[model samples]
Target: MVDQAELELFRDNVRRFLEEEAQPHYEQWEKDGIVPKSFYRKMGENGLLCVDQPEEYGGIGAPFEFSVVVLEEAARMGFMALASNLSVHSDIAAPYILHLGSEEQKQFYLPRMASGECIGAIGMTEPGAGSDLQGIRSRADADGQGGYVVNGGKTFITNGQNAGVVVAAIKTDPAAGAKGTTLFLLDTDQDGFSRGRNLEKIGQHAADTSELFFKDMKVGADKVLGRLGGGFGHLIDELPRERLVLAAMAVAHARGALERTVAYVQERKAFGQSIASFQNTRFTLARLKSDIEVHQAYVNECSGKYQRGEMDVPTAAMIKYATTELEGRVVDQCLQLFGGYGYMSEYPISRDFVDARIQRIYGGTSEIMLEVIARSVLGR
Candidate 1:
């Protein structure tokens, strides 16, 4: 567990790093369509990338709570793309190596990953597969040598264009259903691995969401991430953490947006009085403040449960679904408070409005979360 004083110090350090290095240039990065790799290396120098990875792997070995603190702070700075990218590298991608990779793999990958010398991505979604893992069509066939020949494509991959290492999900036995799934840790510099275009989106313009193609890409047996047939289970095992981080992001985003909107209304006057003084604005903000506090408490509880290793899929899904849905509603309401300024690209609320839309889409759709929760309750 991270003590309060230590956590406070770490938070302050992260804030300084962002204000000095990230926030000033974020709009340009959005226009550039990616955060430069040099900035990632800078994060490494500051020991901000992977806080909870084992010390042997160049991490600080702090509790997972420390990572949550990083995510919350990044969100507070309104850098959703950077926050999402780091979360994918730290929480989603690195853990696969830490928990499942061979010692050689861990030693080789984790250190560079910790230092941001290597960025990581996970390839789970395909043109055909988004919510359903079993629906993926990418394949990896044994070549009768020590390696396998891979031929498939993945879409909507986070950190896709810039990843040095990617944990790719593939089907080893196409006829065997989910039992045939496998994971390969591929180095992007290898032959036959090519990145597709950096996808354009309505928001998260700074994030490197893209498509990846493997045309007869060959990976040695040593590159296989987990048991060849265990990929589905591997994804399931790690999802609690993924969903938990997304839940934290949802709450943090809502909080930041609410705080900013409150400040905006209080200062801007209308009808010869501050908008905040209007009864309608007060009621709207009052309800939003109460909802944000309630949701934050639930998120905090979920975070504690996760750190204790007691978080289950159902609860993670519940918070992810609830908090993200709440994020959308809150951002929308807050944008309304800004009136015309909310729609302007120069306003932070405009970015928040669009960026919050994806929270329900990725990390499993809100509909998928509801289905998972329904299964638990109905036992069907």
Candidate 2:
């Protein structure tokens, strides 16, 4: 765990890196439809990408909170596309290998992942499957030579275009429903692995969402991640951390919206007075500020629980659902304060509005989260 002084120092470094390395290029990256791969390497060199992995694996051996610092600072600075992609690399995919992979797999992947020589992505969402993992058609069949042949496709994969490796969910037993699922660690350079065009999106343009295809992609027995038939379990196990990450970014993103809107209103004038002087403007901001702080507190509590390994699924679901919902509302309200300017693509709030939409949809939809909470409440 990083001490308060060290964490704050790290935060300062992250802020400086974003301002110097990311902010100047963000608009261009958005126009390009993807962040350049070179930036990831820059991040790895700066010790900013995966701060938590052990030093032996080319990391600084910092705690997971260090990774959260990266996530929160990026989102807080309105570089949410970067934050979204980094969360998958540093928070979700790398941790899966770190925690569940065999020592050999760890030895090969973790060092490279930590170094940004291997960008990581998680592949689970399929074209036909949204919230229901059981509905996925991607499958892996055992070959006669102790390897498995994978044939399936994944869509909306974060970090997909630049991914050097992927931890993917595949159905290993078509007849076994949830029990049939398994995870595999794949080298994206393999002959049978291919990538489709980077998908266009309404927001987060630089995040590099892609459609991935596998046709007779072969992997040895050593490529299996976790148990062969435990993919869903692995997904579930990792989801709390994943969802918590979403919640944290939601809070930070919303706060960024508020901060920018605050500056805008104070300078934006109407009726011969600064808009911030208006009662409506003051009250709206006051309300959002209050709500944001409250959510921040709750997120802080849950985050501590997560760091202590005490966070539960239902609680994680609640925070993710609540914070993302708040994010949507916050951006909408903040945009309204900007009046016509808010609708312009040039305005930061405009991007904040669109980028926040997927936060609720991905990482499990808001509706699915409610169902998870309901089940916990009813013990069903």
Which of the numbered candidates is closest to the native, going by highest lDDT? 2
Q: What is the TM-score of each candidate against the true structure?
A: 0.98, 0.98
Residue range 191-273, candidate 1, lDDT tens digits: 99999999999998999999999999988999999898899899888889999898888888888898889999998998999
lDDT, candidate 1, at 290? 91
Tens digit of per-residue lDDT, candidate 2, span 227-289 = 989999888889889999999999999999999999999998899999999999999999999
In angstroms, give how far residue 178 of model 1 lies from its true place. 1.1
Which window of ten consecutive residues has the lowest lDDT sum in model 1? 69-78
Position 271, candidate 2: lDDT = 90
- Candidate 2 ranges with C-alpha deviation above 4 Å: none
